[model samples]
Target: MSDSNTTHFTNPSTFILLGIPGLETAYAWISIPFCCTYTISVLGNFTILFIVKRETSLHKPMYYFLCMLAITDLVLSTSTLPKTLSIFWFNSREIDFSACLTQMFFIHCFLAIESGIFVAMALDRYVAICHPLRHSTILTNSVVAKIGLAVLLRSGMLTLPFIYIGSRWPYCTTNIIPHTHCEYIAVVRLACGDIRISSYYGLFAVFFVTGLDVFFISVSYTQILRAVFRLPTKDARLKTFGTCGSHLFAILAFYIPALFSFLTQRFGQNVSLHFRILIGNVYLLVPPMLNPIIYGVKTRQIRDRLLQLFSRKWA
Candidate 1:
């Protein structure tokens, strides 16, 4: 298996995904739970997006960004999971190179959008908290729309190179992928041709975007802390921080697993593939599951609204 990767082969055919090994015995039971969770994630995110669009009260910058994030979640979860579950249940794990690259394209695109929207949301909260009087003026609808466009343009452009790079690298005869979806790094690492450019470009892009976003988030929070301390009333400071707490939690939850996965990939080459797959799932799936829950907890108004909706439905 190790030597097979280096030998170039012309017939780059269909690949089999060796989904988390040894779980086949319980595949039936696993499918049921996985399908339920996946459906709920997609449905919940779609519902949030709808509610945000339908409710005029959520037209503010924060909720505008939340709606965008919901859209990202819906697309991201939908793009990767349903097919994966189908493969697990039906044993239809074969995928051609072109299809794999397409999957890789959306994965990175959605990831970039996720990070971009998160940074924008954090900035929105910072402005709202530190400059409450001018919040409406600063976060105008036009401004929010521009931010959304910029994120889409930037993420889409950044991922185009990846598509080009993928096209150039011919696959070897060995046709086994280790995980469910076409992870960018994992896919590129399998190429028989030179991947120095892809590796360099990818690492630099990840560090540049995710790193800069983290830095900006840190700076925003620092300013927020200073502003909070100067508040005359404790209640005022708490309220201000509370506004951003959800965004902060979501950022941490999403970024930490991602950073860890990439770092381990770079340095922990000797680690078992099973562990890597476990962390990969955590990186991909956990964030979407946590984002809405975190926001629901942090924002009392949103929380109350969701609870009221659920109660009315269940009653």
Candidate 2:
């Protein structure tokens, strides 16, 4: 542990975070790549949202949930990426306690939102498959609106306590978050105080948001699969699977890294820092880019339309 400091755990004042050994690296070189990732993630997600909003033909419950997801992705990615880029590229990793709390708050809230959004998508698929005739009634405009509102509320209430708990704790001298963002568990782990309460909250967050959401999504898909097997034509079956494939792809891209790192840390598996870094990149960077590609651009009709729109505007 190069950052193995002799600093006391009690009455801590400042933290020294071990950012990716880029203090010696030139800022200009790091900034470029950082900016590029940030730009692409933001632009891609936002473009998806914009096209969904502007195209009235896409006003179904399925795409409505997708638009909400795109909004969540944009918020989730922005909550951490820019700051991470600055830390790596500009060597500006020293985050204030208040700001760290705030960042952690959004990160948690948006992540919860993202998780719920996935559940909502799974439910959408279920209705589309199981109750095709009454799908409109079940997945109505008002219902979808309420579900979106419910997602925000669920996410907000779950994370609000963590924010309050984080604000009250004293941090360890080394403030550097191991991963790029100030996640609740990682952030509180730096605290020198009695972390029993913090750890409990972290566990609660894990079970409440990630674990619960994934559970429901799995349940939703089980029902969806049963319904899928009963579809009349092979073409109908293929189309339904196509709708779900995008969401599942995005979910795997986001969760795989998170699960890997969390398990490695909790189980005391001697994971390498380099390996952790790669996992962190997969968690943060890949989903934001690939999500748009899967749900938006790869949907041939949407891609062709967007390209035509762009060509018309440029010409």
Candidate 3:
């Protein structure tokens, strides 16, 4: 029989995901936190979706954007967490070539979706704060629906090239991916051929998509702060700040680690391999786990609704 580990095809038959190199001995212990985070991510995002759908009072652009965000987090976390847990809990790390590419595609797609949703949310905040009178007229239900579709299409189209180019690469040897998930950069690094194209494109996509979103988010917040400060009373300023606190926290939670991971991988060559891998995993895990909590706690409406939900259950 042919050696199961060796493959004759242009593409390797399977890729082994190395979940946290030098930490295999502690996978059992490490799985505890990962499982807890995954549980919270699923339950929290779904609760946001449920509450938003059930509460017709939340049928507005801001809430709609929150719904989009919740959905993206749900998909993004689910895309990788299950497999990651399998590796940690059961040592099932072998992923087929096509499956690996598919996972990478969805991961990138939803990541871009989340970033686009953040931009939409920023724009929603801008309109609500800066152009209060026109906010309703501009971001009507139909308009919000159109924006949702546009976000999906834009993410899908832009991320297509990532997987397309990745699929064509000649991954002849060293199929072990030294990370918990099939990250774009990690997987590409395993390719036997020249990886200049994949590397450059990944960088371009990161900056073009995430950098643009961060820039717009910054501009939106600047305008929002100006508007808030101009309010006549301290109470008015506090109220405006309160309304935006959740989104600001969400942005920081997602981007800070993401940027750190990217920069460390690209420039921090002296950084330990395990540290880079850990940061990458944290970048993927943190946002999904924290976004719902941030919104639920910071937004009074969501917090009140959640309280009412549990109160009813208890009663």
Candidate 4:
């Protein structure tokens, strides 16, 4: 393990990814699950996009947000999974400095964007359930388009600094990262100089994007619940909450694992390195795989459309 005191380079051309530091013997086995995850995530998200595009009845603000979420998930998983698989299956770990920064940027950027989409979806539900009469008016096509653009711009602008800082920083300590992908913190840890700026900025970005998003989502749901309970009948309450079931499941699916992984990565010093890495991989892979499934199962419209499409092919 090379440290800051080791022979340093002003600018290294490439960095080595170690896949999983303590799990070398199981790389082949690990690749199997990750391959399956990537395949399912791609197929599931694409299916969602296809169904949304082809089904006119489904053209609503909620589905529009779902489409945005699907696209973000596609990019988020793609940015890391291919390279991770290469390292696991073929032992190809060398990544160009520029390429590493690009991967890092996309992974983090799409993550923030995905979080923003969840907040959008939550607000959509809040309006639908809380103010059904004005939901359509409030979340107009133009408004949704502006929200999507804002998400993209916000994530890109915030994440660009990570790339800029990573690129300009002198990597004198080492070029080898112990994880599967080129994470910002992992890369910066190799720098020979003080890394307080990078560390502080990363924490700030996380709180600014994810923390605020989570707060908004929570508030949306709280208002939704208040409105839901005000319904006159038990059946009405159940039916109203049922509409939100899928969104709630999707939120837990994405955030629970993600929060765990982030906490373990930052503070779980006693946790096994491989365990932390695996959790990180799970947060990235599992949500993409589960999002479509949760929506398909809990959403009658999507489920019916899926059945119809499959039936046509079979017939």
lDDT leader: 4
Scored by Cα lDDT, where does model 3 land? Answer: 0.86
lDDT of 1 by residue, 185-281 (tens): 7777777867899889989878987988788888988888888889999898788777666667778888998888877766678977767766776
- lDDT at 81 for candidate 1? 78
Reference-based lDDT, each prediction: 0.78, 0.74, 0.86, 0.89
Task: Give the worst 10-residue stretch by lDDT in candidate 2.
Answer: 8-17
Q: Which stretches of candidate 3 lie over 4 Å from their true place?
A: 1-9
Clashes of each: 0, 4, 0, 0
Candidate 4 residues lying further than 4 Å off, grouped into runs, are: 1-6
Please give, for residues 250-289, the per-residue lDDT of candidate 2 as tens digits. 8887777777765564554476664665465456666777
**Each model's Cα RMSD:** 2.8, 3.7, 2.4, 2.1
TM-score of each prediction: 0.90, 0.85, 0.94, 0.95
Residue pairs clashing, model 4: none
Q: What tens digits encode model 4's per-residue C-alpha lDDT throughout 1-315?
A: 656557676678899999899789998889999999999999999999999999999999989998998898899899999999998888999999889999999989999999999999899989988889998899999999999999999999999999999988887757899899987787888887898998899889987997899999999998998999999999999987887766787888888888787777777889998998998899899899888787654678998999999999999
TM-score of 4: 0.95
